[model samples]
Target: MADTARRTDDLLAGLPVPGARSPGQGERAAGAKNTARAARSRFMAAHGEEVYDRLTDGRTRHLRLRELVDAAAREFPGLVPDAAQLAQESARPQADKDGREIDQGIFFSRLLGSPLAGPHLMDAMLRPTDRALRLLPDFRRTGFADLGSVTLERRGSAAHLTMCRPDCLNAEDNEQVEAMETAVDLALLDPAVHVGLLRGGEMTHPRYRGRRVFSAGINLKSLHAGRISLVDFLLRRELGYIAKLMRGVLVDHETSWQSRTIEKPWVAAVDTFAIGGGMQLLMVFDRVIAGSDAYLSLPAAQEGIVPGAGNFRLGRLAGGRISRQVVLWGRRLWASEPDARLLIDEVVDPAAVGAAADAALERLDSPAVVTNRRVLNLAEEPPEAFRAYLAEFSLQQALRLYSEDVIGKVGRFSAGCAAPPA
Candidate 1:
């Protein structure tokens, strides 16, 4: 493992950083690329394929992937650039810094794009994390689990997974991502739970005090402070709980040739608003119930980052033109608007959201709901398409995370000079 790790580090280190070279460095860049390719060939000759095959085989594949990540992290501490480093790098004027994140992103990108490892990587991602598994038994027994930034409660046939983070208006950070995935795992793993429901907890923010606000998106405050990571937060999120919500947990080490997910239908209740990442999530839900006055937006354009899966999925939900308007032009959709109807299935008064959610859950908890959902998902967005999207998304998002525009936008948002789209 140590030898494999060392060789892997050398391969990654030799790869030329994307979008970093000056205009005059084309020749040098080509030379570097050739050198990196040769290094990769050498690494493969030195047992790269054997390492991947051994690590991603059988029932313990996911655990082995975890071990590989840990080993890589230890070998190259900067392999997972923490939020602070990201923020500092973002503040720089040029997007020329060849930070470790770029290399790490390339490493994972190549891995995911590889035929031998891509399917196994997807399976590992779909499987619940060790922490989530650890908390499952307790949650299943008690029907309630509090995962710091998120909570789960089993109510009749429904497992309600609520996002908390009142201090940040339910904004997502690394901690929130972990907790949310764990809660999602619990909701799907519980045998008694036939349906899963998601909502935001009440916020303490002055504007929305004592009221549920679905999500303010990617926690700009944390991003500005440099608390998020490329792998742990960004890649883990899109591949982790978010994917789980769409495809559910993989029950075995079976190949990707067959569908064997233990998935349940999910309904999201949009209380106040769903912004950025929050809106990205609604694309995967079976049903979305929103308050009449609630709104949704994907301000990825303004934020200078790609909204997770929104680019690929939103177009299918809201049409290509509207999707471009929302993702590229930062258009906001009010729940009561006709344009919003494409995304929201039901719109109710704010006070009636609880009743409406309960009713929706009851309706969704049918014997064939999961089967129907699987059929619909397979037709609309197959697993292969999703896998390919992420293979590219991983690299694109990593580049955007450290761009100068993104840093400036985050800084302005953090300083309260810019407001979320109206």
Candidate 2:
């Protein structure tokens, strides 16, 4: 996001150092060389040293950082990491874990410089394959006012994303969306994570008491209060990490190029309800295990704005006609119905949904799962066609955001809420 402003090398050099050798001394060069050797030693021990040396041989090690990043882009895509996960994993090498390339993209920036840094990081982060993404250093949300809405925990070969805005039935605002986006990005990049589980905060908030509700959709209170801007909404949904993606793209891509579907399977455990934006997200989940009494609906018609990307993805799950009713006519989909059950893979007791999701994901943890997912994605939702639909959806959504109907809806929806959030 830095706009090529300052010369990074000069900036790093000009900064005052404590107890350091004088400028232009070979000491710094020796230090950098030592770092390079350490990286080589680790890579070699892990069976990738030859690949590293071949790519970096005779070249200045710092200058060669780009080649590793580019290799990850070409060969591993979304798995090329930025920071937090790598830092955590590397910090405890004595702990058992899978081996991977030097995952920190900034290692290159610190050594080679920013001009070389920015583009490679961008490219590595933007790849659509399962491994395609770069986390910010410390790897939290990028453009949000708060990060309390979503939390991530890395488990062995799994990442758990917990949505925690239970005060609004776990409703989403720009902050929540941004936080969830980073959570998903972390799961995609971490080689240790082969599965992801998403669920709600439940008893985490006082207003909800002890009840568990998956989500109430977009935070109408936030939208009405002007807490979320039209630009933030559009950019995040259209181009940011949580953009509508074809599950099939992930499933069908080569091991190297697999998109989200093939990248890592995500299981959604819906406890109470999924409405509008919340219901819409199930379209991208590899598996959905919802409570028996849970309900799903796309109430965009009532909202007077598009329900996130629900309109585009709903039809693939619930047929065009059913989707139309939910999206256009405001139909509440109950988990008990055959139609609702069609979209959700399993229906379980509300309290057991998490266990059900874990069991389902465990069954899917196989070497061929990605290939199998790709096959399903290709057969069901081709990427090209889905992208075309998104293009149209985005256009209509932009117009809807600032429309008169939406302005009226905001007033009415806000009136029905508790109060403007503190």
Candidate 3:
């Protein structure tokens, strides 16, 4: 571990300092840009392949991957922009798009794009988070885990994993993502549960007061506040809980060929709306039940970021044109609409959502549900394809997260000038 840490420190040290200016007069700015470019090239030449090899060496554990990231942040402060810096950057009228941390994004983009690192990264992410591991034993015994932003309660044959950020309409943030994934781990690992049900808790937001909302997607407030991290929130999310929702929990560290996973059919009950990430999640569920008055939309264009795996999976569920309409054109599909039926398995009265979910969960708890779901997943996504999509997504999303457009959009949304994407 000491040797590895030393080597890692050396590799990180080679990276260009974010705003280092070459010492001189008049031509200092241009000279700094040129110097930074040279430094980057030198680092890539010396350490790029080594970094890939290290990532795919198959010896480093998931915890070690996190340790390395933490080390990078500690050793090179601005390299991995902490939460406070991220918040500061988000609130700026014009963000520092080419800031020091942008290089960190570039590093991850290249790293994730590697054929070796791509799948390895997927494997690492699929392993349950440490928080899940810590809480699992208690949850397994009690069949109930109340993770602050989300909760897991095993009810009969179904494990109800409720997203509970009522104040934010269950919008996903790092803490929520961690909690949700941990709850998902509990649900999948519990032997008594045959089906997993996802639903949002009641909201405190005035417009949706006392009402349950499926999700408002990424917390725009958090994003505008710079509380979101490129790796921890963006990459970890799609690759972590959301992917776990589709693929299942990795139970053993065997090769992908002989891997063991604990998986169950999942049912999503959409109450008020499934916006952005919420809508993206529906693509992975085995069954979806929505209130007739509910709606769905992927406002990726409006938000100026990729809507998780929506691009890869939405087309598979709703076909090309409609997928394009929702993802690219900002089209919202109400549950009653014909197009909505493509994504929603059942649309019932708002009051009937619970009953509808119960029925779906009952049906999903059958002996063949897991087998058939696995077959369907293999036919449609296959782990390899999903892994590749996320590899590219990590890079594209990192860039977008720091882009001026996203910062501006988030700023407007934060200021209450921009309405939620319809």
lDDT of each: 0.76, 0.57, 0.74
Off by over 4 Å in 1: 1-51, 54-60, 63-66, 72-98, 252-259, 416-422
Instruction: TM-score each candidate.
Output: 0.82, 0.62, 0.83
Query: Which prediction has the highest lDDT against the true structure?
Result: 1
Ranking by lDDT: 1, 3, 2
Q: Once superposed on the true structure, which residue ranges of model 3 sit more than 4 Å away at CA?
A: 1-49, 55-60, 63-65, 71-99, 253-259, 416-422
Candidate rank order under TM-score: 3, 1, 2
Give residue 212's lDDT in candidate 1 (0 to 100). 92
Top candidate by TM-score: 3
Residue range 1-422, candidate 2, lDDT tens digits: 11111222233344333124355643553354335435533443343333333344522242222346455334432323324333443343211111122223222322222233323322332343322244433432322122478777765566778888767777777777667656666666555667778888765455556877788877777766555533334434433454323232122234544343436677888987887777877887788999998888888888887776566667777789998888889888889898897679999887788889889778776668766765786787654454445444534564565455775776677654442221
lDDT head-to-head 1 vs 3, winner: 1
Better by TM-score, candidate 2 or 1: 1
lDDT, candidate 1, 1-422, per-residue tens? 33443444454445444355455564554454345434443543454445456555533456423355555454444334344444555554333343446545655666676666777788878887778789888887899998888889998889999998887888888889889888888887778899999999998877777989898889887777666667778888888899899999886534335557788899999998999899989999999999998999998898899898899898898899999899888889999999999999999999999899899899988868878899999899987788788878877887787777887777778753123544
lDDT winner between candidates 1 and 2: 1
